[model samples]
Target: MNSTGVVLSAGDWRLVLDPHRGGMVRALTRRGQDILRPMPEGADAPFDSACFPLAPYANRIAGGRFTWEGQAHVLAPNAPGQKHPLHGTAWLGNWSVETGEADRATLLHHHAAGPDWNWAFTLRQHFRLTADGLEARLELTNTDDSAMPAGLGFHPWFTRRGVSAIAFTAKAVWLADAEMLPTVRATADTLGDWKQGAALERPDLVDHCYAGWTGQLRIERGDGDIVLEGEDTPYLHLYVPPGQDFFCAEPQSTMPDAVNREAPAPLLPGETRTVTMRIRSA
Candidate 1:
């Protein structure tokens, strides 16, 4: 089956959804070229690429060499660092369309049982269009003969232009190594404070992950505000690239290096796991 893409437009906002590959919201824009950066003449265009995932996993995995169940599985690197296996293959793989109706669509994909997870899997992603905003849900189930470790999340690029203030609550903070991987943990106060619903205004460089989130965030622009409420996501990662057009506010389950740490409960065969998030114009 071909990759499925759907467009939802409201006034000046346009969201493009591709169901086949992790059901990613591949593009978001009004004029489309507003975020264009200078590219090499004849190079592939950025707009043509998928918008990427929004959670559980963002960015890349080094060399795809993580150990699970004492076994190593190689993953292909799809980003700048050749040393890392970027984003899960589901985002690039084909997804079957289960149902499509007005304002909503559902898509599904399956991965073979692996040695580490030991379970066959089926994942479903849902998209719903509404006058308030767009909502996307990702659900996964262990369909294998055994239980396995699983991680899930979102990776959306959000508009950060003229964002005067950002306010939120955080409880946990992770210390990262030079490679940008989580290495340590401490009380949020160690970094500053564990304040919730506090306002931060273009304060400084931030590419940090925070846990103990309430799943409620508000981004205040000069003229408008956007509210994002995450369901089943207790952790949040805020990525603000220097002088970049877009920033990412991701909600995720399972911390980085979960596979190595053998973190949390595994998805048992016949059991389902899900994460959902809602975005609305405020």
Candidate 2:
């Protein structure tokens, strides 16, 4: 392993993580078959990796604007061409390896109070490979003196080849505007019977947040089924671009633009919140 990379293996599964590259899982494979989309060699962008952690908050904040506790804050877009603050800062920040073994590894990243969000916190990501699958845990603690709005999640990109169906349960879904910001909330049933599973290929692009999620999802492929289960995550974001090589089934603690909505949970000083994603193949 390199200075910034860690590998974990158990049974026929293997996971590669790079602490220097947003602490992302660069590759996930079972018996030499890609589960999540593998990162290209030398790829440094967090979005290019198989999976990355979302901390403090998840998804976009409209025009990078929000108000909390009587104070207004504006976050600059981290991406070159985006107008909104996409994802969170932790994914692009360097993390230090806290522990590593053949089957598990832990990484820690600390974000000091700054103009970006004006909050201090510590985030921990743990990855473990089991006999059947991989388990990931994200824990965030408020290190500041005042309470702060926070959310946690994981964005995993699964290879789209031969992906025939998807299954999940949710009560409502958010319709996005041209800029991909939430515009309206609609009953998920209108999107079809996703609970039983739905065809993967759709004529239109899908980039919406499903509210009241059951914290469970399954992606059916030609070889096997990939199941994702989350704890303490009430929202799931589905990003399936037309003709894309990969799709994302993200499990988040809150909805997109949560800082502007009522979804973000407040974390008091010294308090910690955790969200876990378990991945298994059937």
Candidate 3:
């Protein structure tokens, strides 16, 4: 297993995985052109990388607080100057290399019950570069004897350059408050009529989560179009922060702050939940 900047290529697609950098995808390109934002040299954390895995949970947990199984838990703010914990611990920690080969790689992470949250789990991820695109899978198992609530997802930052429009279908949306946490539940078009591919040329920030996603989407940039699909992903999250050169199209298994959601099911001990995301030319 390579520690950093390992490149895998198949046909027109190329992927770079940095196992030591929180098991992040440094870049994803097709035909020598970036399909996702390439992480710059000397870039900071997974936030600066092209893509990274979201485990245990995805998105923000308001004020880093949540209640699970009738017990209250609080997580210290992990991101720079942010009041709440964003994403999970995997994006900021080192991942052990389980296997690395020519067009595929596998990484693993083990979390013990601690202050961050009261749960223990093991996360395994596999990335395979296909002839036309890339495919990845995540399996999270509750290693703890007690039941645990968990979420699985992927975070891919698509390059904003030449980006024209994004198209997807959803039944509803999760509106966010100023703190970037889900607030109101509105129609899919509450932000943009994305059912028909909405142009993203405006300056306003576009950060919201769409529920009831159809499990697929297409991104049309000046370069070309790519289709992204996820299995076991019921929600699609968009984080098009203002003035950024990249935007995120995330496929996740749960809504933000899911731990606090009413009667969330727990992953029983020795139980495993899996999700997958695939990308290819449209």
Candidate 4:
């Protein structure tokens, strides 16, 4: 259970996690082989990197700081030389184990510390392995007596080596400048014609987030295909690290500047926000 932190099983699938970086190594089900896995440390690896929470939200925030409700808040630098805090504070911290069954595990990460973000709150991440596929859910609550703006998303680096055809449909697009921050609104056309799905030939160089997904994503390879869908998570972040063999299909409720731009639903006093996603093998 604690040898290499790699959860493996021959019955259905395997689940791997690196306790140090809070990374998910592998999540496979009966029908599916593995949803997310750790690649050997080397060149041309699909996703040898770690997965973090994009949070407090995900993606990039210019200058690692943002203005909300006329108040300025600065987050610690998660991305160096970029001047922005990324993926929130949970992914880097060791999450407290709440419950771990044979096929499921629930982890809690409470940032009820000092007042930093618009609202101080407690968050919980639930990781589970089911008969269909692996699933993740994020739950957050506003500890403040008033409403606040908070975004949530997951940064899961999927194996892109064997993946050939990828396709999905989204309705909205956030225009950004050189810094990868949302600037204006446009049709999802600029993201390229992914309607018919494109080969994973050159995706690593891309570092952008997309919104208004139809809740279904299709990923096809030579041997297998996968379909991802869910109810709570409406937005998706498409991160392709240049030259790497993997790409990240992150799901979330808001974008980078959602807190400042008011993109998703608004939170009220004692409001709880939840985002969930499911992956079904095809």
Give the whole-model CA lDDT for all candidates, comma-separated: 0.61, 0.89, 0.86, 0.65
The residue-by-residue lDDT of candidate 1 on 140-179, one tens digit each, is 8777776666677776666666566566676777766666
lDDT of candidate 4 over 235-277, digit per residue (tens): 7777666676567888887777665665455566678888787
Q: After superposition, how far is residue 51 of candidate 4 from its true place, in Å?
A: 3.3
Which 10 consecutive positions of candidate 2 have the poorest summed lDDT?
1-10
| Pairwise lDDT winner, candidates 2 and 3 | 2
User: In lDDT terms, how accurate is model 3?
Assistant: 0.86
Q: Model 3: runs farther than 4 Å from truth?
A: 1-4
Among all windows of 10 consecutive residues in model 4, the one with the lowest summed lDDT is 41-50
Candidate 4 structure lDDT = 0.65
lDDT of prediction 1: 0.61
Ranking by lDDT: 2, 3, 4, 1
Better of 1 and 4 by lDDT: 4
lDDT string for model 3 (171-246, tens) is: 9998888887887899999888889888767778988989999999999866778999999999999888777778
1 or 4, greater by TM-score = 4
* Location of the lowest summed lDDT over 10 successive residues in candidate 3: 257-266
After best superposition, candidate 2 residue 36: deviation in angstroms? 0.4
Candidate 4 C-alpha error for residue 204, in Å? 8.1
